[model samples]
Target: MGFRNLQTFLFFLLLMLLGLSAPLSAAEGKRLALVVGNSAYTATTPLANAAADARAFAAFLKENGFEVDSLINVDRAGFARGLSTFSKKIGPADTALFYFAGHGMQLKGENFLLGLDAELLSEFDVDAEAIALNSITGIMERKASLSLLFVDACRNNPIADRLNASVEGVTRGAALKWGWRR
Candidate 1:
C-alpha cells in the first residue's frame, strides 16, 4: 500500500485494537498520546511533510479523545523533556500512544529516531545524540496497560551510510520489538 494509506490503516487498526482491549467503564483509564515531528534538521536534508503530518495526526487523535502532547521540529533536549513529561503523565491503566515523524536509522540492530538538532559525526554520536526506540517502548511497557507506537521516519539514512563505511562489521538489521510480553 501507499505510505499515506499505510498510515491511515495503522491509525484505524490501533484504534480498533484499543477498542477491543480496553475496559468498557469510563473510570478504568484515559487515552494519552505523544506525537512528535522533526522537519527542520540542522544536519541533514529536511523533510517537507513531517511536521504537518504530525500536526494533522495529533489533531485527529485529540478528536478521538486522546490527551495529545504534540511537538514539532524539536531538538534533542526538547525530545527528552517531552518524553519525561509523557512518562510522568501516564497512569497504570492508561492507554498510551507515541507517534514520530522524522529521520530514523538502524545501527547494528538498534533503531534510533533523530531529533532536529542531531548531528551524527560518527557512530558514537548515534548513541549520544539520537533517541533509542527502545527507550520509548520501555517507558510504555512500565507505565501503561496498552501502548502503541507509530514511527513515520525514513529507514535509509545518509548518516548510517557514512557510519557504516567508516566502521567494520556494521551490519544493518531490523531490531524493533514491542508488545505486552516484551
Candidate 2:
C-alpha cells in the first residue's frame, strides 16, 4: 500500500509520541480535527486512495473522541469553508489537528496544498487556485493548547517539475527547495 493507506496509523503513532495515546475523556478538553483529501486534480493525475484515506482517518479520530470535519475532493472555496468551520470550533485548551492527503507543491518559497479542481497554467497560478499551508496553520495557531498538522503529499509533483523546468538556474533551485527539509 502507498502512504495514503498508512496515514491513519501514522497519525495514531504521532499521538503516541506526543503522549496523547492515553484516551482523553470528553470532560478533559476538546479534540478537533480537520481532515481533507484531494483526489481529483484538474491538471494532474488523480490519487487513487486519497478520499478513502481521509474518510478512514476521520472515522478513527472521531472514535477516539475528536470532533471531526471531513472533506473530500473539495475545490478552493470548499476548502476555505471547511477550514473556517474547523477554526470556529477551536476553543481554548482544544487540541487541533489538520490532515491533508494529496498533491502539494512549493512555489516561490511558499507551500500550497492542491484542491480537487486545482489547475496550473503556470507556477504563478498556485497562489490563486491552491490553498496556502499558512492559511491552515494560522487557524491552528490560535487559542489551542496543541496544534498538529499531518500532510501526506510528499510525492513528486508535476507542478513542481514544471516550475523547476521553466525557471532559471538559481531561482529554480531555490523555488524547488521546500525549506522545511533542510
Query: Could you estimate the TM-score for every candidate?
Result: 0.88, 0.80
Q: Give the per-residue lDDT of model 1 (tens digit) for 119-164.
A: 8878888887899999999899889988888888865567666778
The reply for model 1, stretches above 4 Å from the true place, is 1-4, 20-26, 169-173, 178-182
TM-score of 2: 0.80
Clashing pairs in 2: none
Model 2, runs deviating above 4 Å: 1-27, 168-182
Q: Which lDDT values do the candidates have, in the order given?
A: 0.83, 0.75
Worst 10 residues of 2 by lDDT: 169-178
